[model samples]
Target: MRLICPNCGAQYEVPEDVIPQDGRDVQCSNCGDTWFQPSTQMMAEEAEARAATPPPATEAGSVDAAHTREDALQEPPQDAWPSAPEPEPAAAEEHWHEDPDAPAPGTPPAAPPEPEADPAPAKRRLDPEISRVLREEAMREEALRSGRDSLETQPELGLEDLPEDEAARRARQSEERVARMQGLDPAPQAHAAPLDRDRLDPQPGSRRGLLPNIEDVATNAPGETKPATPPPADAPAPPARKRGFSRGFLLVILLMALAILVYSNAAMIAESLPQADPYLSSYVAWVDQWRLWLDAQAQALAAE
Candidate 1:
């Protein structure tokens, strides 16, 4: 029987009897693939026919022949049964196939080839609007790097942009605004009425200080003498003289009175007030010394 390995495509020839009628496990010699080798109906029938055929006729048996016949007639020992033959080596280039209508025994159905993997979808393209925005941003950055001022790149902001009336009104307002701040009203003036020298003191050249008011002035007609103004009864009077003794006269009198009183009461005061004793004694000593000096002068004069 012909056999082929599905994995390595290695072909092999094996005897039919080697495989059992039911099925036998077989391994590929080249690829070592193991599969169940099921026998075909034809091979099973051939095996049965061979078994049914009678054994060849033998001549008169020798002792060894009779023993062999008896051994055959009796069931052969389990060890004596024929073992399955090894598979023959496969040729490299050779291959075999059975008729499609009469499929080979134990042949597995062919597997369909796997579908090829599809290429990864192309990366999604960027939206046009987004790409445009990115480009504009890049341009703006490049402009800044080149040191171009924003005012030059953008629209101008000037008076030219304003309406004529608005521009004129703004200019007038600016002119009205004083450049220098107004100083505080020349150092706040007093709330009282202004003073006039002529009105306050009507009479002139009179050194006597007085505040004669304008009501003192009299209006007279031509050829008529004006009546003299009567002096105000409430006018301020002269200051009275302060009566007091002169400083020199008062001092001299005070010294005389003190000396007379102190001498007259010296002994009595010293006895009654012990604190005054020292002062009184010192004063008495000074008077006595003076008297002695005067007596000595008088004596010298009399001698002269």
Candidate 2:
């Protein structure tokens, strides 16, 4: 039997029994078009019915028409006519026919197997020594908690059970331990003597002089004798020598005096000496400015 694709007019030579009597959906190998195809028996019956029907009347004088009809009748039936051999089914079409779910040709390849869902990450196992250490730490923590709870519930020592002095000593020791841990100095002992107010204040009979008496503070060693008589109060006191200015001081004073004289007469010097006029003029201007500043300072001070 011959089948023709309605969409692309591609023909396939299939077995007569390939299509059932009830008809079935068929797909085109060339165009991938699908449509319901009637059975060969039903198609033959339809053709026979079409042939039994009469043709419309025509003019009897039309000889060419009559001759064409006669020739068509004399010719073999369309089923007996030789047809061109069909090419072998393509690999893709054969595969598609074998497996309906197979993808069509020219489609993108299946999405790379969805990356296999990255497989659930395997659980990591801890080292044996690490696990042991962890367990030991947990047990130690549990024991510490238990011990702390018992300590919290235990009765405290009373004054009768522990002496006040001993308790104070223990508290001081604990405080010192904590201070040492924190890099601090421990407190001084309570037995240390406090500063005496009497010692800080002068005695009633003591003299209120700017300089203290050295004789009172001095102590004589054992077996040491005191001098029988003190030195006479004004027994020929040595003549006091006077201090004079040093040579450098005198030089500095002389230089200062010369500078003052030159500064005071700078304008007159510039007029008298033409060679030194420029230098003296600059010096005189500087001196005049200094004098004006000094005068302004003096006036401000007087006003204040």
Candidate 3:
């Protein structure tokens, strides 16, 4: 094969070993111009191949051309085509089948036309009064959107003066109220109509579901209790326990022997009784009562 550099008009012979007869690239060493070359030998081979293979319209017959070349190179199946036809050489044109995803080489893209500059938003032709009104409107909107537009100082706590227990109780109440509002348990039942205050407040002395009052639960006079001016709110509540009672049962067992002293000793005598006597009956009755007590205890446990 041969190549001619158009710029330098120098011709270079292509290495036959590298230049396959099929369409391939050949570069002019002088000008570095690259062009495609297709030889006559390749065309003849292609024609002979076409004669051996099935029609290209069939799915199996339309395999890659590169694979056909591989078969010729590796084994060159005798019954298969000996050669293939080459296409006309293609010139190194300025344009190619460009991938849509790529930008063209060396051409500045249209500058997107600068969006026509928008004329600087007309320079805001407002008088001072209008400008002030717009500024105030914007500020008002911002404040409304962000309720915490201004910073707030936290409530100051005094180590010596602040009432710790009261503060913690209030905090707990606030958190629970927030949780209730956000649909957490124990959720306040929504009413079809506004509920009366009486429904929400507990009756005096009723401890059904209400937690014990802190002052009452302290169970000791504030003055008498010198642990701290206020007990640590985070401290465990004094182990609230009620005295419990346990009961045990015992059976009265008695054994007796009688002797008749002849004369008036013929009255009456109780002999040996069977194992299943009144003693067994009494034991069974005691067990039944104990079982009833256990059942009551179980019910109490479940309620707790």
Candidate maximizing TM-score: 1
**Rank by lDDT, descending?**
2, 1, 3
> Compared with the true structure, what per-residue lDDT tens digits does model 1 show for residues 75-137?
856666788977665752256655678746898867889999999999999999999999999
2 against 3, candidate with superior lDDT: 2
Whichever of 1 and 2 has more lDDT, that candidate is 2
Alpha carbon deviation, residue 288, candidate 3 (Å): 99
The regions of model 1 sitting more than 4 angstroms off are: 1-237, 240-247, 298-304
Cα deviation in Å at residue 40, candidate 1? Answer: 99
Candidate 2 off by > 4 Å: 1-245
TM match of model 3 to true structure = 0.13
Where's the lowest-lDDT run of ten residues in candidate 2?
192-201
When 2 and 3 are scored with TM-score, the better candidate is 2
63-115 per-residue lDDT for model 3 (tens digits)? 66667877879984475656776654564344457699777799777566555
